[model samples]
Target: MKEKKWLRTVLSFASECRMKMILSVICAMISVAGGIVPYIGVYQVIILFLDGKPMTNGIVFRASILFWAFICLAGYITKLVFYAISTMLAHFSAYSILENMRNRMADRLMKAPLGTVLDQPVGKLKSVIVDRVETIELPLAHLIPEGISNLLLPIGVFAYLMFIDWRMALAAVVTVPVSAVMMAFGMRTFNKKYAEYMESSNYVNSVIVEYVEGIEVIKAFNQSTTSYEKFQKAIASFKDYTLHWFRSTWKLMNFNGAVLPSTLLGTMPMGMVLYINGSLSVAELTMCLILSLGIVAPLTSFTVFVNDVKAIEYAVKDADDFLNLKELENQSEQITLHRFDIEFDNVSFSYDADKADSPNYKENSALCDVNLKLSQGTFAALVGPSGSGKSTVARLIARFWDVGRGKIKIGGVNIKKLPLAQLADMVSFVTQDNFLFNCSLMENIRLGNPKASDEEVIKAAKAACCDEFIRNLDNGYNTTAGEAGGKLSGGEKQRIAIARAILKNAPIVILDEATAFTDPENEDKLQKSIASLTKGKTLLVIAHRLSTIKNADRIIVMEKGRIAKTGTHKELLKGCSLYKDMWEAHIGAKQWAAGSEKGAVKQYA
Candidate 1:
């Protein structure tokens, strides 16, 4: 069954470029024919000499030599021309197929539930899309055309040998079964070893990416060399596994290699015996030797593709798994919302749905039986300890993941009924880890509204308090973000993200700790900019700092995935213990900051 699936995968991918593949096969067949013609020419020359033909002036010998030369020349020319054409067509088709596959995978990811995509590690996904997809190109570009020609040439030569002397033909193939058994033994553990190798490779990739992203933290803590140990261990593990796998297969491979191409071992001895007994003529013996030798070369060429075939099979399976992942159930109907109000009713969720049978599943629930609502244009704040489901609630309103049970509605309509694009237009979500592409600042902001004018972008930047810092940069608005905004400060990146959200001008906005990294000096200006951008719009903010949302219309304090209390600042202070405790912490931090500033001034004086 597994082999069937692998074959189906190969056929399915090949079917995408069927016409080109067929043309390539035709060229391959012609090339095979060309390769076999020289052997037949040699056979004919030997036959004439054994038929008692005179060697006068060596006329017949010269004519035979010339005939063989002309046939070989023409055959090779045709072979080169057709083979080149075949490869060109295959490569074009391979690239075209890869492009289409990547686009389809991207589209699938867009439609997939956020939780599903997040569950997969970044390194695994990269391997599937970049490395695995690229593996298919080898088989498509080289294996199909060359493998077909090589197999056919050997088969053709073997058939002619059988016609001349059946016994010699049988003797030629006597070692084949033995070699096959050796190869099968070599591959007995290949699948398990390959899987282990892949796991090690993915671990190495993940650790490398983690190390690079966390380099700042590592350096700040003076632990750069110690932090690098994890990455080094991962690389070393991969190397050891790869070498072990190779070593396990080495002896069997050598045996198979030595025996599979030794077809002439049996044919020469058997033909010589037949000739001595007056059963096989000298010409027939010569024919058998030459043909048997021809067969070995093509057979040896075919064995070289065995490892490539295995790689292609594994690669296609990996890519297919990702492409077939389940997508979120989103409706195609586009509905117009009447209001920007949001509601969460009897909502419960867990990240462990796929791992429900595991022992760790019980602790994976992120939300449970939570209920809440926000009126249109209301500025609501969700305040909670870490892992209290504050961010989950904000993400649910944006349909990042469907609730495990119960329903979430926007404007009194089930959010699932709205088209994804339409729902996206209604909400602008800004999270702390904002990803910026490597492009100009102007272009990055424009991503919020692709059709927005330059003037509009500049206006949005000004409102987000990003204008001054952007202008101070060497290229102003045209400066590049430099790979995930690495060139900019944390506060600067946050402001740029806020600027993007502000430019979007959506009716609803969700901020998941958006100001967590901003400095106190920049916080006031950013808050004012946010007020202007979200004036009269429904805004939901998840804040760790109690001071930031003190003036919010309502504050919902969350504890253990449920709402502990909901009220205004004064009401919450009077009734909610969690709220009061958080407020006290915020005030104490502020006092500490004031004291530190005063001591610095006194020291300077």
Candidate 2:
């Protein structure tokens, strides 16, 4: 029943290339038939000798021998031709199936919820897509063609042996039951061991990726030894688990290996006894030896594929788990709104819902019944310390995650009812840690608007103050960003991201510390670019630097996921104590920076 299930899974994956697989199977069957013909010819020659025919006709006897030799040669050549054709077809089908599976997985991931996608680690996803999926190729390509031929050829040979002498056929299979017992014992804990091995492998992959990504942090914090300890431990654990698994199966596997191929061990002795007792003929015993040898080779080959079957089962399960993730719910019908005003109506949320035991989990909420509205064309700035839910509010408005309670409306319609594409077109969000793909600078910006012309992209770049540095680069806008825009500075990457948002030209914009990386020298120029880009649009800006948002129409002060105060900068300074303390701190930081610069300049002089 378990073997049937494995076969069913294999067939399901092959459904797309079923015709090719069937053709391959047919060719394999032909190859198996041809492969057995040579042995059959050898049996015929032995039978002729034992018949006690007169040898005075020596010419006829030699002619008969040459005829059998030609038959054997033709059979072998046919086997070779069909085997080659079958393998080629199987490989083509396997690669096609892999391509289709990968494309479907990628499409499903795009539609899945952002939170669900983010919850998965990069290494885990890479393992499933690259490593796990590749494992399926071996079973699909070789197992179908070679495995089928191996199984059927042995059955055919066994039937021929039965025809020669039924007792000898039964005797030949005496070692099979004993070998099967050894194989069963070896496989008893195979599933458990494989699961542990997969877990250990995933852990090693995760730790290696994390270590490489955090190498700079490790150096800066003087934690090289400590960070490497975790990496070493993970790798050591994987090696130990792998070695333990192999050791546990070693004895049984060796026993099965030694016993399975020794089919003639019982056959030769049993046939000799039967012949001595005058129950078996010499010709029949000779035929039994040749047929028994043929049977063992195919049976051994079949058993080897049992391990490949288990690997495919596990890999398919992992791929299915990832492909089955839930996607976000949104209406298919697009709805055009009357205005771009945003409203948070009694909103509450928690990032910890998926992480019950996390140290950062909060029972209170990330946003507790927050109520606020931004009128169309108004500039709203959110100011608060870390963990105050400022970023959460921005993400909620952009629908990166659904609110835990209450509805967030855009133009008086629940955001959930809006088509995802339409809602995406309505807002532009520029996050602090923006990602840039490994491509030319122009191509990266074109991601925001694939249809935009080069001139339009250059214009947006100029608006975001990215044109100057981009032009100064060796290839101007054509310069590659490298991986994650590693070729550019933090401030430069931030500008490129802003240029993308500007090109989007949405009516509503959310900036979550978008200008935090900019130097003081470029701050004024970036603010001007932002004002130009956001003209006549509703803008929500989250900033820790209070001086940056002083000209806002309204300043919202958040504390512990709740709104503490909402007013203009001057109004908050006089009436809101929290806002006043934050402003004082901001002023002190600016003065300290000015003093440090003066000291550095005097020291240099």
Candidate 3:
């Protein structure tokens, strides 16, 4: 994952497009050869003019001049053609790799433990999907091909130089190694700084996204100073990092820019003095001078390519980390459900053990040795205190995370044996924070089933009580939801989420406080819709308000990652101490709400 890996990886990609790559190399050679020969042609014309007689006969001199002219003309034309092909190859390869990468990353996210994604900040995940992957284009497409072409030019020039005069060639060769050593030293510093720079950019992006998303909350709290301070901090950090990088990079550039070309510059005067002192002939001097200039393009190109190769190496290292991440092992099998019933058998899990460096958390079990069975076509409620693992139970039922011990079975089949897509089709969940795309309402709703008909979408909307609000809007179903549906009320967005779940028609539905945001007026309709949808389907509801689960077929009360009690509402109220206490507290709140001047308490269940 260090710098320099990029060139090796990119070369692998180029190797796949072997023919185009070979053609590019050939074009580079032809272009360099033509450019170098012009000086020799000029030198020959000068000798003829000075001596007032040609070295060869008139026809032969004319033919030689024509031959050089043809070399220059053909070289220029071939260079353009080869460069075009090289660019196209790079473009095609980059775009192809990017396209596949995006698709694979999306698939990985889909299969990733849902709780893992929930735990991460939305802005950070957004940065990964949109910014991090997009940044790879530059090094992959432009740097790889151009870098190789530049490398070849230098090697070609050196070979031609050695052929003409080894002593002067040795002078040029010796200077390159020295310049390379200096460039390498500079690169070491630049690489570390560049890594820091990229990290700062990602942080700034995350902060900016958070600021924009929470603008309303900031304004409502009258926290403009706090918000501005955050923005100022992020921007200042980014600026400092960028400035440091530029300053360091400028020094590196100065060294590389000066040292490479200075090799030929220093060699030129010495070669000319040798010719004048009769140690070399005029033709030989002409060849040396001409070839030295020829070496300039390739030699300078080699230096630039060195830097580019290092950059690409770092990029490849990053990409390899992404590619090396382990996907679910048994992901390809088709999903099979013998029955919709779900069972958790002595399952135990702890998040800390798996992480490389456990963050701030005491050794608390997320789930203990819990056993439960959820029969098909029944409405079951999981009631618990905040850390009682009710959400963990729901997540396990959906196979969001594999159990640390024992097994989770859908019907009689282990969830691990099921195909991911098939498992997805069998279950639907509407979480507390409903996510919506920045797209038209219709499009967002259609995510439940991309090929769903407009009629089906309208039907689903009606089922979730979303049709009225949607119709009242000026754009109707065409209205944009804004980012994550920020433009809509929480209730409106939740109903849309429910509508999506309904449209999906999965056999099992998990609601993580689905009605928490709904007002009383909409609550009745939504509750009835949910009840109707649960008919002959497995339903698991997580609730804070006891009233919401009063009518559920069964309720399980959980405490400290273990089940406290399980029974009907009346049974729990009579037999379970914790349940009775929770119910009493809830009843007290309801009475207090009835007595209050503000009217009915806005209870969230």
Candidate 4:
């Protein structure tokens, strides 16, 4: 049953190319049958014609020549038809399966635990989703059906040989066991090497991706030499590993190549003995030669296919392992929320190692003694330096990761109890580094609320201060953002992300440094937009710029993953030393910049 289930995973994609599948199979059968006719029929005709003396002349001679020519012609036609159909089906099946798999992988990313997805390198995940999944296509579309077809040919050859003479049949069957043992030994060595080669390939891919993506930073920091050295070292290591693997498998491949022909040496000499002993006729001897010779090509092809299958073992295992990860449970339950009052009650949380690579942390202590409450329709800001766990707070509110210690409640219910889809609908997040899909500007904005109308999109874009800039572009909203909106300026991308958040219009909003990289000119407009947008929503903003959230109803100052201070921004500015220091620095910088500008103008005059 398990094996059947496994087969279904590979071939469930058959629905995509059912017509071609049926046609390919039919053509293959015709081609194999035609192959047998030429192998046996031509030899029989020659022997019969030569043996006749008085009867074989004129019409008989011409008829025999025509018959052989027709058989050869039919063989080539069937073979061509079979090959064309099989290749077409393979291409169609592979492309369709890859498209579906890529979408499935993307959906998996959305549903996977935040820690799980984030822990993986961008390159590693790219390899799995794009590269590894692609590798399965060849094995699926060609290897599977071809492997089954090859087995059938071997079976047919054995049966035909036996029917002609039981002794020859037994002789052919006896050779199979020896061949099987040699094939098995070869396969074992090849499998080990194949696995090692695949692993090294993934590592090499990761290094190449990282190096290329970081080229700009490396040059800016004068680390290009070091980065190149690291990249070269990784590539060299992979090359060495591949060479070692090839050395191990070379012997196996050579042995398999030689094994089938070696069986012929035994069969041909033995057939001569049978003929001399009056146990075999000339016809029988000729048939054995034809059939046994046909065996070598298919045997070699089958061995090559087997090796290809073994080579993909790692890719299959990697795909299966990724699929086997425990996704968030109860993701489909029905949930309804009228009010959004987020409550974190003694809610200590830690990155689960099963899902992430975390520091050596004591159990249940990412955030200790953490108690906070955000009332419905209020704006709250979390303020801290980097790694003070501010972003983690926003993540927990978003339910990206379940709280480890205490309950996180939304509308008086545990967040874990809420359906993931429902939770997603109820909350909207604008992350620090806003990710925009490589699509039309309109489509990227509509991603937040697919049901939203074009008018609604324009309205949201205006409220997020993005409409004016979008209109300035030649194609306006139709322009493609390119990968991660790399084509757009940083401020433009940030505003577009804000437009998405506006379109979502969820009861709860989490903004982690949404305006961190914007210029002052746009920042003012964005601040006004955010204030107007969150008037009736429960807002939790991870504040990178203190000036952006001075009007927040409450501010929680975090230190070392704990809430060091909590109050209104004004109160904290007066009472909290850390808050006071942060505010002073910000204010002093603004004043000093103004003074410097005045100084520079006076000196120029």
TM-score of each: 0.87, 0.88, 0.85, 0.87
* Residue 323, candidate 2: alpha-carbon lDDT: 65
TM-score of 1: 0.87
Per-residue lDDT tens digits of candidate 1, residues 1-605? 27647657556555567788788788878877777777777777687677755455477767776887787678777778787877777787777677766767788888888988988888778878888889878776787678887888878888988889889888888788898888777777777877777777767877988998789999999998888887788888888888888887788878888898898789888988999998799988988887887777777775668767777777777877777878888788798777889999888777766654455543666887788999988889999888999999999888888777778999999888888899999999988898898999999999999999999999999988899999999999999999889999877888888889889999998888877777767666667667666777898888776777777888999988889999988999999998899989878887877432111101000
Flag regions of model 3 displaced more than 4 Å. Answer: 2-67, 171-174, 184-256, 277-279, 301-307, 316-321, 353-363, 592-605
Weakest 10 consecutive residues of candidate 3 by summed lDDT: 596-605
Compared with the true structure, model 4 gives a TM-score of 0.87
Worst 10 residues of 2 by lDDT: 596-605
RMSD of each: 5.0, 5.0, 4.4, 5.2
lDDT digits (tens) for residues 3-83 of candidate 4: 235445545645766676677667666656655666555665766666773274767766766877687678767666776
| Tens digit of per-residue lDDT, candidate 3, span 103-191 | 66667666666655567676655555556556666666665456655666666666766776776676666567777788778777666
Local distance difference test values of all predictions, in order: 0.81, 0.83, 0.72, 0.74
Ordering by TM-score: 2, 1, 4, 3
Candidate with top lDDT is 2
**CA-RMSD of model 1:** 5.0
lDDT of 2 at 435: 91
Model 2: how large is the Cα RMSD against the reference? 5.0
